[model samples]
Target: MFRILFFLIIVVSAVEIALFVWLGNVFNVWFVLFGIILTGLLGALLAKQQGLGTMNRARLELSRGRAPAEKILDGLAILIGSVLLFTPGFVTDTIGFLLLIPQTRKPVKLYIKKVLLEKIRNGSIKVFRHY
Candidate 1:
């Protein structure tokens, strides 16, 4: 797992660097810098909006004596998306936006839910109910 993570880090860094250089060459350094800043700002704003909404839903679920499983996943996605958006790279920004948008996030959320369920079924993750 560590090896895979290291490899992915190296690959993603190379890709981001190459993209930065290519975009800078095509549209000047300032334009590329401006675009990065703009995206970061926009991403922060969108993440805040989505995060609050998810929090509200979670609160509602808890108030109704229900587990906010889906809302928790949404929060996780938003947190990851926000972090990615804050990272200075177009690739991460694109992925961040995908996770932030509800429509685009649905598939990813479903996949996560499937994985969690599988883990639970296999005893990789144990759930203990207190009540």
Candidate 2:
């Protein structure tokens, strides 16, 4: 796992740099810089909006004495998306947008839930209930 993570970090960094250079050559340095900044600002605004909505939903669920599992997953996706958008790279930004959009985020959240459930069943993750 560590090796895979290290390799991915290196590869992603290289790809980001290559893309930056290519975009700079095709357009201009300032244009590329401006795009990065614009995306970051837009992503931040979107994340804030979605995060607050998710929090409200979670609160509503809690008030009704129901678990806000779905809302929690939505919040997680939004948080990750926001972080990716903050990162300076087109690939990350694309992924970030996917995670931010509710339509796209549903599939991602489902996949996350599936993986967590599998892990718990396989003993890789443990869940304890207070009650």
Deviation from native of the Cα of residue 19 in model 2, angstroms: 0.5
Error of 1 at 91 (Å): 0.2
TM-score of 1: 0.96
Report the C-alpha lDDT of model 1 over 13-122, residue by residue, as the tens digit: 99999999999999899998998999999999999999999999999999999989999999999999999999999999999999999999999999999999999999
Which 10-residue window in model 2 sums to the lowest lDDT?
8-17
Per-residue lDDT for 1-131 in model 2, tens only?
99999999899989999999999999999989998999999999999999999999999999999999999999999999999999999888999999999999999998999999999999999898997
Enumerate clash totals for all models, in the order shown. 0, 0
Q: After superposition, how far is residue 30 of candidate 1 from its true place, in Å?
A: 0.9
